[model samples]
Target: MAPAGPDHGGSGTPEPDTGTQRRLARRLVALQSAHEFAEEIVLWPAVLRHCPAGDALVTTALEQERQLKRTLEELAHISPGSQEFTQCVNTLAGLNRTHLTYEENQVWPRLQDGLTARDTVRLARQWSGARRRAPTRPHPRLAARPVVLGTVGLAVAVVDRTRDGLTAR
Candidate 1:
């Protein structure tokens, strides 16, 4: 999670690519989106099935994720000198921090209770694999399912990687 303070260089502002701030923002968003996508695909189902109450929590979390994506998109378009951009960056950082802590506190324990040691390891591997192929940018319009994500993700990953290469990101 990003530190919830002044932009320690990852604000996704319209800064020059030569600087580390823009690159750091991209990397942070990429990793965050990848992990969240993995959890949505691999973890939520088991949680919903084994722990009935988890459905609501997962749903809320997913909505928050969508909002986060929208905020990111806004950030991408925002000028570096704009106050709105600064606020958006701070907001994104706070949301990420809160979501992660909430997941660790409320969701992790329930998932642990539902999954066995072997299941945990298996799911961990699956999660890792998903993250490897997941898109760096958010696709809020896409419904995040295993089949849809696995199929569309490949194409998106290709495009993202291509863009990353061109931009030297």
Candidate 2:
């Protein structure tokens, strides 16, 4: 993810503050979590039901997401001013970029192959709803299961949004 700040004149200079890094990290986690959670709840099931190679594809994506989630949680403990924190963030950016590209290039096609225009539209709506209701922080345990993802995710989203409102985040 692009670190939050002014777009320096393509000089490749990073924002020189921990606060910005922290905010960027949190934002990335929230976005990635929402996207992954939506896939887990909506697209993956459809993939398995329709695509011949769905199991393998979804498994790889799941592993990537699991690793990314773990790394994201670890980021919360790192001092963003440190070199290690920068390295970790860079790693996450690369991983997230790769995952997104793969989803678009591979998983999306498979998911869309059998879907009608109306079905696609419906799925899009559901996906957006899922993202909106998804938690803004890592919850690996709750995220592991579908039942918990639906019920607990809703609860956590409420709490998270409330906290965000109070914190002005």
Candidate 3:
């Protein structure tokens, strides 16, 4: 669970090769982007509809996500072997930890109180499906338009997965 909290002192390579660092960075970007998109498509809407302060909560979370996506986009362009890439990774990790903390603390509690148990379960399934099919690449520009995101997600995801290949797995 996102609200489980952050791993402040996580493990890392003291000196990873360019290939290893690049792969790790891409994997992180892919997973995080997919996770955020899932939230955008399913979780955020539920929050907006059910939670009392859903609007405010969603706004904050989305801002955090926007920052993360921009960082991920920058990371995608940097040379994997350079010092800048390592710094970008660190920056991205820090931002992610902060975002997770917000979700875990403020967002999750509201959600738990706002929705029924059955709703949560159903939302979970939807969120999982969204994650499975969401774009693997960061689309920072789309973060501001929740309506379009909900509608065009499938199309954007198809294009992203096509770029990823016939099958992302």
Candidate 4:
């Protein structure tokens, strides 16, 4: 299924219950929470013990998360058809891209150097437990690609319908 994003235009017709949207939202939240847990509970401690660079990386990631959360909250208020919603979605996507790049390029490698296999497993367990206890609302858009794509698909469908109405005039 297409990932959700602001760019997803809606159909002029009633919105169909695309299980994709809800699933994407849920997964996005789960992924973000898991990533955060891994860093805070597992990676940071290991990095502090072994890799000094981990400190800077974790700090940067946390700041980004804070900003992303704000943007997501704003986007949630604006309906998919609104310009504000699109802008927020775009911002979110950009943030996600940058964050993922940073993690994949710098943070993950540093974490590997700092953490042993046993540490990783222990951290993973902690993350799982945290996720189970985390609240359901306000799922963070952790990664931009999947969520944005899905949202964009829906947004585009909406836009197309609007355009069709104008053209039909």
Question: Whole-model Cα lDDT per candidate?
Answer: 0.75, 0.79, 0.85, 0.56
Give the runs in model 1 whose Cα sits over 4 Å from its true position: 1-18
Model 4 vs. true fold: TM: 0.58
Which digits, one per residue and each the tens of the lDDT, describe model 4 over residues 1-169?
Answer: 6545544554344453445443454445445543453344444555566666656776787777667666655654555544565576688789889878987887778777777898879867865664444322233443322244235433543453465357541
Worst ten in a row by lDDT for model 2: 2-11
Report the C-alpha lDDT of model 1 over 1-169, residue by residue, as the tens digit: 8764346555454434434545666776677767777877787776787665988878877887888877776766666545776688899998888888878888888888888899889888988887887777777787866677778866887787788789877
Candidate with the greatest lDDT versus the true structure: 3
Question: lDDT, candidate 4, residue 68?
Answer: 61
Which number leads on TM-score? 3
Q: Give stretches of model 2 more than 4 Å off.
A: 1-15
- By TM-score rank, best first, the candidates go 3, 2, 1, 4
lDDT tens per residue, model 2, 1-169: 6654458445566567878878887787778777778777777777777778988988888888887877787786788788889888888888888888988998888878878899889888888888888777766666555677788777887887788789887
Give the Å shift of residue 108 in candidate 4.
Answer: 0.7
List the lowest-lDDT window of 10 residues for candidate 1.
Answer: 11-20
Please, what is the TM-score per model? 0.81, 0.82, 0.85, 0.58
Tell me the lDDT of model 2 at 23: 89
> What C-alpha RMSD separates each model from the true structure?
7.6, 6.1, 9.1, 14.4
Off by over 4 Å in 4: 1-38, 137-169
